[model samples]
Target: MILITGAAGNLGSAIINSLLKKVPANQLAAFVRSEQKAEQLKKLGLNIRIGDYNDIASLDNAMKGIEKVLLISGLSMERLKEHTNVVDAAKRAGVKQIVYTGVTMKDAAVSPLKVLMESHFQTENYIKASGIPYTFLRNTLYAEVIPFYIGDQALNTGIHYPAGAGRVPYVYRPDLADATAVVLTNKGHENKTYQLTGDQLYSFTDVAGMLSEVSGKHIAYTDVDPVAFEKHMKEIGVPEIGIMISTGFAAAIKQGDFEVVTADLEKLLGRKPTPVKQYLKAHYVG
Candidate 1:
């Protein structure tokens, strides 16, 4: 059976949903931290394995009888160690392959998010050193987060941020999950890396235009200064860390960190991935 770590998370849940279409529920296992979180998976008839990435024994039990594992990266200060714990447990449990979800960056050394991406780099290296066959899905920014980036009052106040003219090939989350499922259930993907990105790149300016067209309201993008953006976020009650992360990503976009577009997602899904404009129309127009 294939085990998916962080199965209660959005991406993990989506992957489980996609995998159910390709394989029986009995063929998949959902790994969560608690019995309460496994309720939905239980209703789906999936084997719910309660485990924590930090707990090697729990992870070992979760990986029992599992042939392959999808190691969703964790979000924490101890993320690197947590990922290693999962890898170690998987190795001991004799998992044949490991699929990791990592971030997509053109160059890791110069990427503005290098510090944040370091854990992923270390996890990838750890997986490689573990001698387990692996597939790395280097996923780009999710299009689903555009709403958060633009904010609820974007249509009224126009698209105000510090992204400048940089473009991002934001792949839809479900598409990534679908491609991941394809890799999990298919062969010839072992020891390979796939950049899961949208087929087209879109700047905030382009997004503004799309929003205007979809909402029938004039919208514009303002490339504000980083300092001013931070101040505005602070005035709006955004936490210090939130401001830092937002500015960092804006800087990364301005530096063209996420401008890389690839057909890997399309090839895996056997069709073109969803476009940013289309996603805007569906979510904003309604």
Candidate 2:
């Protein structure tokens, strides 16, 4: 049986939906924060287990009779500890394999993405040290989340960002989820790390063009100074952590941290992934 943690999350839900087409419902389980959070998955006749990565006992219970686990990365200072708890529980539960959703920062050893996502590196180390058969899905930035970073403020004030003309191969969350399901169901993935990225590379200017074309508005991109961007984030009442991530991520992009192209994603879906223009229209426009 395969179990997915953080089951209510977007990526987790997509993975579950994709797996349902191949794996039987009886063999699928969802580990969520609570029964209330899992009602929809339960309605689909999936086995639901209430567990938190912070709680080892809960994770142990959730992992019962589960052979493979998809440990979706967490989002906080406690991420590393949380992942370690899940790995330890899975080991005790006799899980045969673990599929980890990790990050892909180009030249991680010397990038701002590395500094911001230190937990991912630690978690990867812990999982490897645990001696469990593992598949690491080194996913790039999610294009679906571009809304959060780009913001509607960009529409009114034009696109103001610290990133220069560097490009990012942003992968769709659903596509990564679909790929994760395939890895979980198939064999020969143990100890493998797949660098998954979109087929196309787009810069912030490219994104501005996409928004302009789709919304029929004259949107523009301005390359702001990093200090000015940080000040702007503060002026907009962004929290300290949010401000750091925003500025650092933009800096990483400017330094060509995410400008990677790979055929692995196409191999995962057996088709060309959707284009940014199409995604922009479908998401931002009518």
Candidate 3:
């Protein structure tokens, strides 16, 4: 059976939905952390297993008889510890191959998630050493989240950020999910790394221009002072530590930290990824 951990999440749900089209329901298994989530997956016709990242024993039990596994990265502070447990359990369960969703962060990138990038790479190394056939899907920033970064505040308050000249090759989440489904179902992708991203790049200025065209309003991208931004974040209850790390990332973006381009995603999905403007027009204008 092909098992998907963190099965109730967005990425997991997308992968599962796509898999249902290609594989039978009995061949699919979902690992969740609660009865509510289990019942939800069961409603979709999946074999359900309950487990948590904190509970290694449950993970071990969940992995039994599962041939292939999708190890979705966790968002917890103890992520490394939790992911390590899955790797160990998968190995002992005689799983054939494992796939992981990881991030693509340059060592020099200045973002709040830089520490997360370090941990991700460390986990990649550890998984490699474990000797199970593996695929590390180093995903780029999601186009879905670009709006949150831009928000409705951009329409009324203007787009204010420290990302000066940084460009991001943002791909839609469903596209990434489709590429992942391809890797999961097809053979010959084992023991490889794919930097999945879009065919084009867009800076924040490009985003503002698109917003202006679609919304029929003047939406400006402003290069704001980092100190002012930090002060505002503090006033709004953003933690000092969060502000410190985020400031670094925002500054790094100005240095072109997220400026990356790749075609690995298109080759896998057999189609062009969704354009950023399509999402912007639908969500921002309507």
Candidate 4:
């Protein structure tokens, strides 16, 4: 059976949904911390394995009889430790293969988002050292995050940010999930890494134009100074940490850190990845 950690989460659930189309529910096992959180998966006839990344015993118990594992990265201050716990548990369980979700920053040393991505780099190294056959899905920023970057009042106040003229190949999360499922069910992907990104590059200016066309509103993009952006976020009651995180990502974008694009996603799906304009139209149009 294939065990999927964080099975109830957005990306994990999407991957499960994609997996369901190709395999039976009996072939799938969902690892969740609480039974209550897994009610939907349970109703779907999946084997429910109770576990937490913080609890190695629970993880080990969950991995019992599991052949392959999808180690969905955790979001926490203790992310690296928790990920190591999962890796260690998988090691003890003798899992045949491990698939990990990672970010698509080609050069972590020069990327402004290095601090945020350090755990992923460390986890990748740890996984390699564990002697387990693995596949690393290095995913780019999701197109679903555009709404968050633009904010609720973007239609009126325009896309105000400090991303500058740099572009990103913002991929759709569902497409990434689909590719992950393909890797999980198929072979010849062992010890490989794939950069999951959109087929096209786009900047905030391009996003505003698409939104304007889709929503019939004159949306615009303003490349504000980083200091001014932080001040605005602070005045709007954004937490200090949130402001810092946003600024860091903006700096990375401004430096063209997310500009990489590849045909890996298209090759996996056997079709072109969804365009940013299509996504914008779906979410912005009535």
After superposing candidate 2 on the true structure, give the runs of residues whose Cα lies further than 4 Å from its correct spot: none
- Per-residue lDDT of model 3, residues 1-286, tens digit only: 9999989998899889888888888888999999998887898889999989779899889988898999999988789898899999999998999999988656633555566566778788889999999999988888777665665667776788877768888888888888998999999999999999888888889989988888889989987888898888889897776776567666766766666677899999998989888888877777
Q: RMSD to native for every prediction? A: 1.0, 1.5, 1.9, 1.1
| Candidate number that wins on TM-score, 3 or 4 | 4
- For all predicted structures, in order, the TM-scores are 0.97, 0.95, 0.93, 0.97
Q: Which has the higher lDDT value, candidate number 3 or candidate number 4? A: 4
Per-residue lDDT over 219-260 for candidate 4, one digit per residue giving the tens place of the 0 to 100 score: 989999889989989998999878878898899898998889
The lDDT values for all models are 0.91, 0.87, 0.84, 0.91
Clashing residue pairs found in predicted model 3: 110-249, 111-249
Backbone clashes in each candidate structure, one number apiece?
0, 0, 2, 0
Per-residue CA lDDT of model 2 for 48-104, tens digit only, reads: 999798887899899899999999998877788889999999999889999999887
- Pairs that collide in candidate 2 are none
Question: Candidate 2: what lDDT?
Answer: 0.87
Write one digit per residue (lDDT tens) for candidate 1, span 25-132.
Answer: 999999998999999999999998987987777888898999999999987868999999999998998999999999888887787778777788889999999999
